[model samples]
Target: MADEVKLLGVVGSPFVCRIQIALKLKGIEYKFVQEDLANKSDLLLKYNPVHKKVPVFVHNEKPISESLVIIEYIDEVWKNNSIFPSDPYHRALARFWAKFIDDKIVTPSFKSVFTVDEKEREKSIAESTEALQILENELKEKFFGGKEFGFVDISAVFIAFWIPLFQDIIGLKLFTAEKFPNLYKWSQEFLNHPTVKEIMPPRDPLFSFFKGIHDKLHSSSK
Candidate 1:
């Protein structure tokens, strides 16, 4: 039998979208099963019992959780459309920066956007800004690690897409062209890439979806 692949994911999720981008880049055919994170399905729980999260990738009968791990697996399994650098050191650097993006930018920015506490929100914003400045200085090329859109690019899906949406929802002016010109340019390139653009959720629906969450958070805090 041929290879069987399935992605259990929620719509409008940057994490899920990144995996989709990776799959599309590799020209892999797979089924996307929409998951309602509010009431997660048995498969999600079964496949990813530890995290109990969406974006659980199943190949044949094996399951893998975490977006970065799944992407790496996809890269290893499919040689075409390589996602990481060929050189050992460069590959190590790619992993390092990807981890930095997650730990520094993605986490802090997300906390800044979603938290109701003013002090906590400000702290997160500051942390995110500091990390973003470091990224801006490092990002001198078309993509991370030079030309090709590879591992680090996929890892930064949150910064490219979701952070802007979050900024809009919360009326925060965190990431902008003036503050980080290199990142602005990079986001444009990453967002417009054919493989990435094809799988990205439309802005209007995504905005509305996130707006509802923001409104709910504020109302609860009140």
Candidate 2:
């Protein structure tokens, strides 16, 4: 019997999106339960008591928290469309970059773009830009995993999708084709992937929502 799989996630969360993309890539069918972060559901709380976060993956009734951990679980369980590399060293490298993205890139980038304080924003932008440049150098091939969208690719989906939107909302240009040609090209390809294209929400509404958040943050900071 196939283990029943279900995902609790928020609509626009990049962490949640990571799991969604991984599931899609592996062709795994699962129920998606959207969570309201402001009023988190009882199920979400029950499944993820520690974080109380979205993106709690329940497989065979066992809960797994953390986006990257869930992605690794999905890859292990559904081996048909494997995302992680088969070799030990290659897998380690993939894991290293994925961790770097979460710790060094995505976290600081979001903080920089969303924070109301100018000094913090500048600091985060410098940190995130440096991380992005490192990633740009790492991408010697078409994708992070080289010629295929794999673990590192899935881990860095936020850079491919949300960064551009955040840049527009904040009126900043952090990523450019000329400055980071490889990453810029990777973003284009990642966004255009059939599965990715299918799951992405319309740009206008997303931008409007982010703009409202941006305004709220700035107003509150005043």
Can you write out model 1's per-residue Cα lDDT over 1-222, one digit (the tens) per residue? 999999999888878988999999999999999999889899898999999998999999899999999998999999998998999998999999999999999888878867899999999999988999999998978999588799999899899898898898888888899999999999999999989899998889989987887789989999
Q: State the number of backbone clashes in model 1.
A: 0
- Tell me the tens digit of each residue's lDDT in model 2 across 20-112: 899888888899998899898899989999999988999989999999999998988888878999999999999999999999989998898
**Model 1 poorest 10 in a row by lDDT:** 106-115
Query: Model-by-model lDDT, in order?
Result: 0.91, 0.90
TM-score of 2: 0.97
Candidate 2 clashes between residue pairs 3 or more apart in a chain or in different chains: none
Question: Looking at model 2, which ten-residue stretch has the lowest summed lDDT?
Answer: 195-204
C-alpha root-mean-square deviation, each candidate? 1.0, 1.0
Scored against the true structure, residue 177 in model 2 reaches a CA lDDT of 96
